[model samples]
Target: MNALNPVFYKEKIFSAAWFRTYGLLVIGSFVLAMGYTFFMTPYKIVPGGIYGIATILHYKLGFPIGMAALCFNLPLSLWGVKVLGKQFGLKTFICFILVAFFADGVPFLLEKCGHPHPYDPFQLQDEVLLASIFGGVVIGIGVGLILKTRSSSGGTDVFTSILSKLTRKPIGMLQMIVDSSIVLCGLLVFQDWKIPFYSWLTIFLMGKVIDIVMQGYSSDKTFFIVTDKIEEIRQYILVELHRGGSIMPVRGMFNRTEKEMIMTVVSRREMVTLQRAIYKIDPQAFTTILNAQEILGLGFKRLEE
Candidate 1:
């Protein structure tokens, strides 16, 4: 009975986690589709991906953007599995399919219900810059959320991954090369320099927003303090700042003297307080402060999260 209880609870926890992941996946896909269907596609802003190529094709050939993207995505996903060996999991397959459905269905339903410009329902066609900015941000948020669940929408990334494997080049470089080539294709097809410029801007904003979303907006700072008053600084950090840190033995390069270095991370607000306290405790203390992009563990984000 006791063994069965543990097993049952474990299964329940697993089920809950599974549901949460898929929930985020669905929401992320919908949001990504909205960005494409409403903003990017209507304005002809190709931000460089399978969707980017689809946008160009939709404008040139009058094909459905979502259907075009799905056509590309499905084959790429299968090729990825064949070459990369099961790297594209069920979540990735489902995520892209959901994105394609939402992207195509929303505009279709809107048109059927009598909305004249189903793609640009809000009528921001003239506001290309605004569309680019918001589109990037929305897409970033969607991608970031999907990334947090450790799944991908499975498009150009798969192709780039395969290229990386074959060429033995860095994946980042390959992805940039692939995206840049696609952007150039948009320019060639559209024959407008402005198209590439706006597309590049969207890409830049998307990258920045993705970083912000994944790492969070908190401006946490990391501090490394070299001080004579190790015990006093340690006490202040532990008692006053209510933070924990590590102490390491160090040998000064210039002076060749043995010393202790304290390393800690704190919120931006707490950093100011700690700086003042450190100055008061040891005016001669050498401190190095750095930006802490993402801090996880005790007194911060949970390790499991």
Candidate 2:
């Protein structure tokens, strides 16, 4: 029984992790679908990716946006596997499928319930700009959640990767080129200048929101201090601040004098306290401070998380 305890706990941990990942995927897919069904599609905003093309088809040919995106995704995914020799994996396939189901199903249910405009149930037609902004934020949050699980909603990224391989262009550049072409297609189809502008705005906001979600709002700062009074500062950091840090030997380029440099990370408030203490300890100390976007280690966020 004692020997089996570790194995039992490991299984429990694995099960919990699996459940958490898939739960996030489901919630992310639903949120992404809501952003499209309510905020984006109704406004005729093409924010780029497979969904952007699907939006155009929905308006032009009366195709269902979610179904259209899936149709494009399937072939693209297969082609990607052939050319890139990379598997998108089951999680990615499931994510896009869930997005499709929720995207189409919700609107259909709304229509059956006798909503005046099933797509724009909130009547956001007159508020296109607001719709674009909120749509980006919501979509960003959804994508961020999906990404945290190391899965993706398989789409144009696969196509872009292929293009990158063929052209030997950077993947990031190819992605921009492909997305831009799709945005231009929307302009030509809709013949509305505002559509592209609003779509670009949505794209920009989504990118910003995604970064924020991934890194979180940082309140930690990193400090690199070069001082002759190394012992004084080291004691203050270890004893007073109760923080761990690294100390290294350094040589001044101007004076050719040997010195010690201390590197440490602390919270915003603690940074201020340390700054004052360092000033009092050594007025001539050279210090550089930088914002720490994410810190995962002892006395910070857990490595597992």
Candidate 1, number of clashes: 0
- TM-scores for every predicted model: 0.91, 0.90
Q: Write the per-residue lDDT of candidate 2 for residues 134-251, one digit (tens) a residue.
A: 9999999988888877678888888998888898999988888888889999999999999999999999998898898777878999999999899999999999999989999899
Per-residue CA lDDT of model 1 for 1-305, tens digit only, reads 34454333222345877788888889999999998888898888889999999999998899898899999999999999999986587778999999999999999899999998988887885899999999999998888888867789888999999999899999999999999999999999988788888888889988898888778876899999999999999999999989998999999999899999999999999989999999999999999999998888888888666
Model 1, residue 156: what's the lDDT?
A: 98
lDDT per prediction?
A: 0.89, 0.89
Off by over 4 Å in 2: 1-14
lDDT, candidate 1, at 111: 92
Residue pairs whose backbone atoms clash in candidate 2: none
Provide the clashing-pair count of each candidate structure.
Answer: 0, 0
